[model samples]
Target: MTGSAGGRRARRLAIGTAVMLVLAGTNGPWLYRFGTERYHEYKINRPGYKAVNGHWDVVEFPKEYRQDTIHAVLLHTGKVLLVAGSGNNQDNFDAKRFDSRIWDPVKGTVKKVPTPADLFCTGHTQLADGDILIAGGTKRYERLKGDVKKAGGVMILYNENPDKPMTLPEGTRFTGKGNGKVFLSDDSVLIPRATKVFDRKTGRFLRNNPGYARVVVEAPKEGTRYETGTQDGYRIGGLTGADARNTYGIANKLGMDKRDFEGIRDAYEFDPVAERYIKVDPMNEARWYPTLTTLSDGRVLGVSGLDDIGQLVPGRNEVFDPATKTWTYTRHKRQFPTYPALFLLQNGKLFYSGSNAGYGPDDVGRDPGIWDVATNRFTRLAGLRDPDRMETSGTVLLPPAQDERFLVVGGGGVGESRLSTNRTRLIDLKAAEPRFVDGPRLAKGTRYPQISVLPDDSVLVSGGSEDYRGRGDSDIHQARIYDPASNSFRRVADPLVGRDYHAGSILLPDGRVMFFGSNPLFADKADSRPGVFEQRIEIYTPPYLYRDSRPSLSDGPRTIARGGTGTFTARRASAVRKVRLVRPSATTHVTDVDQRSVALDFTTSRDRITVTVPANRNLVPSGWYMVFAVDGRGTPSTARWVKVP
Candidate 1:
């Protein structure tokens, strides 16, 4: 004890003194509760593996994701990493059963990234340093049947530098966060609600030094609880800052939370020295599940989210000025559905990749404004290919000459009778009109398959459950690669775990791609075991490794089989970019590829490029079979229609 005021006097004390301490005291400014509590269990266990086939566009196809799935995906370097988890499993903490695995397209093998027991939901991200940073995520019990509230947000650092054999760094349990974005900063991370301070060097959630907040408020010398008329009851006046009440600001206008106004939150900076989270300025729209993209100019562009839905009122998009706490409305208006795909172009143009709002039959005549950043005005991008029909997902492709176009992919649309599309398209800005180019028909099945284009123009179409109409098979683990140059496909390794919903696909910096599946297998004739959800991750490379054989022609080419020049239905070697054939060319008029086959009504033929036999007057005409493929690029394949009956 020290005696002050007059002269400091040191008092002699006993030898030993014990000081009790609690761990939570270290990081306790904010308290948050997160996780699935409705059922006390998460239903969809397996997360799906995301692929940025060719250029990353399009979202999960409906037919493909009808099974079950994981969440987001990333394509880094060459390897693909997918986040998948299983809530039905007895051991929730098993990374093997939950984390991701790398698929080697070269070796044709799958390997897992070794991780801590609590590493589920696949929050791991690779840093520039080559170390994989497994950021905070929920923890499932290692052996327990039910979901338990263990650690909210914990970060486990791992290293896969050489990558030959991956390495898991030591674990440091960070107590405060739940589920949020793990932004890669210089050395540390700008983690949302990160309460605990972790030491990357020491590999531990440290409790030493000024790693905590210590409150020391001045106490008035009074009669304690029995005191009266002392203004001691707790005052909450400061919660509303003086500048907010005095200045001409929107906050003053929104005295109470209003339905008309967007609910905006401010940017907060965590001061390690003060151990406190200081609020700067709130975002324009107080939105959740929102997306923020950092621009080339270093400004973060926040966009599309469900702010005003029906009577509930959701958020649109607004920009935030970090220096000041004010929000600027960027005028991003929405109509019906709010889920849109965003793409930042290299040309410094912010291209909106979704639909122009108010689009019902009754709303078709209404015109929406196209955004022009230069004048801050909305103009018309007439020649632009908009995803008006299907809500398409697309990404910016980084190729040397790919500066003028965007590779757009997937979306669901009403098909003929019971048919639908799992195909992708492209928009070439290089063209004066920037028209859309419909892609080739996807492999036999629907959804679950993706297209990732390599530097060689070959696309890696991955995991999607397709219904084999003739075989009665609802799901197929088939994978294939399509070369645009040859317009042919070759089979690759299919996924062991079928992909379902909430699946994401990303392109890695390397060539290797990863696929992760979520939930139990929901494919047709699937194994409905309790823990069948693939919390597993696998990697994939192209199939060109195993076989170096050339893409041989199906036997040889000769227009229509012998016996006849086929129907020789006037056709030629020509261009077929955006043309959709609905009727056969009139025998009086000629067209591109000669049609060898025909139906009863030669005028309204549904199928194109068929092989037709000569007048089979000698015998009853043979039954017809649809064409599997054709040599459209050059020379003829079959000369006559071969009889099936």
Candidate 2:
């Protein structure tokens, strides 16, 4: 053999070895998972997954909130509104000491805002005018009688004046009603104050305190009137003790107390531009644990919550017309479980995904289905193996808005059981007969996992707990990015602080993610061991940001007409591959129904580009959207707000 021929053969062998090494290192055994479309479909829990690149940093907060922020919504003006009604602690509510702030992410400052009502546990949605309609919260706590029996404490379900017998959960309790003769259902009718009652059979309540049942009653009273055109005024009261207990907890008890909190029918419009909260016309009925979704017609739909009387607000769906700045009751009545994670289908229907933030009867509300707003009709979707475990879970409408697909991820077990789920599911609403299909699982089961739609079209799932709320050390700090194309999740960098219930994340206009808030049992107790309330702010920079030079918009109109085309200059136009308009997110309870990304059709030459707006209001609702120019490597530029009128 010739010496030159031998050298060429060795070179070919070296090249082949390098290629094999790259393939093995990148995907290993799961390389075939991405090899075909069928393979990708079944790659829900694929092994040897590729981890997405990202890093997190804890930012210094300008001032201490002193309260746990259980709710956060991003505003169009690039500031975040933080609300923690009563801070999940009634002591704050009793004193009328609430924490509401506007956090400027760019300036690292928080401006305190006074809340008109207890915004805690309320539903919210962004209006087309970029204002937030804050609905339903505690007016005040309610008092009820509880009888301690050998089996369990039986709570008199008289708060709402129920016609039938209703059972309350075991852990549900009320407190601070004043010391008196406690009543027991045993052979003994009366027990002295501060005496513990023992339930020998269940071995559960073995304390010296025998729970008592009493008929301490209070009538509904007229509340402070806000300027609403609905009626002369609204009344507040008749709420169950259980509803109060679930939200604000029993009034005025210290250390892990859960007995205070009531549902207030008061609603408000938070104007970010003016930085003021305007008391709006309240809802016709009260709602706690409700969900607010922006409809395609530019109206906001309010659904499923405990009424003023603390019963699940039944079949009375209302729509808030931003045009009129008022809530109009729908002629149709609908029943949805509390906080049913609802999404607006492109065809102008609501899809209830069986994801809730924990409330109501377990069995009835766990069904996932689609509902027509006009006729009030429902079509059930099957195939969720752990449908009952969706409490405190998170769901998102997959990006490119036109896809009409949804994803549900990470929920807890039934009824405050501390058990969470790692399962995730996906469904295509555009399917002929849509049903849930299994998707990739999380590293662990998470409760309150925040799902944010990233600019690159991948979904970011981060910050939750394996147990109920933020109990124990179960807070999950790790984050995952779901890639729809691959049908898999790439684990990303973990945050410094672990977040669970009440924690939230939103995609900043600058392409970074801002993580904030976590309200555990005693998360606000800084003196307590392990402290409380994951209050520090953290920002995550995705790997794409470090990949290549990002495209930037130098000059663009602040507003555009529907279906119109305009020219904008983007520096580094040669690197630009995609231009997108993303609606700023209004998030709470791990759900952001208003969030979406619409790709803009564009033609580019040199440093100038002409982009066409969405053809109609249905495609991209008339509102302010963050416009970005994404480079070929998928890194997005700092967004500029563009209003579609």
lDDT of 2 at 61: 60
Q: Model 2, range 1-645, lDDT digits (tens) per residue?
A: 556988999999999999989988987757665567465433422322211457677876655654577678888899999888777665887898777889888877788887777888888887777788889886655333231111111223222222222333322333323422122221111212334456878867554432322211221122222111221111112224653332211111111112223466678888989988898878877788788987878888888887654567777889888777788888788777777788877677788888887667776756889888888788899888687788888888888887888889989886668678899999988888889998988889889998888888888888888888776667787888899878899887666688877778888998888887776753432424543666677888877776546788868888888889877888898888888889888777776777888889998999897888877576688778888888877888888788887
Task: Write down the lDDT that model 1 would get.
Answer: 0.31
lDDT of each: 0.31, 0.72
Per-residue lDDT of 246-265 in model 1, one digit per residue for the tens?
21100001011111111123
Q: What would the TM-scores of all predictions be?
A: 0.39, 0.74
CA displacement after TM-score superposition, residue 57 of candidate 1 (Å)? 25
Q: After superposing candidate 2, which stretches have Cα over 4 Å from the reference?
A: 1-52, 63-66, 141-261, 522-531
Off by over 4 Å in 1: 1-289, 307-315, 320-339, 355-389, 392-403, 413-419, 465-476, 484-493, 506-510, 519-532, 545-645
Best-performing candidate as measured by lDDT: 2
Find the candidate with the highest TM-score and give its number: 2
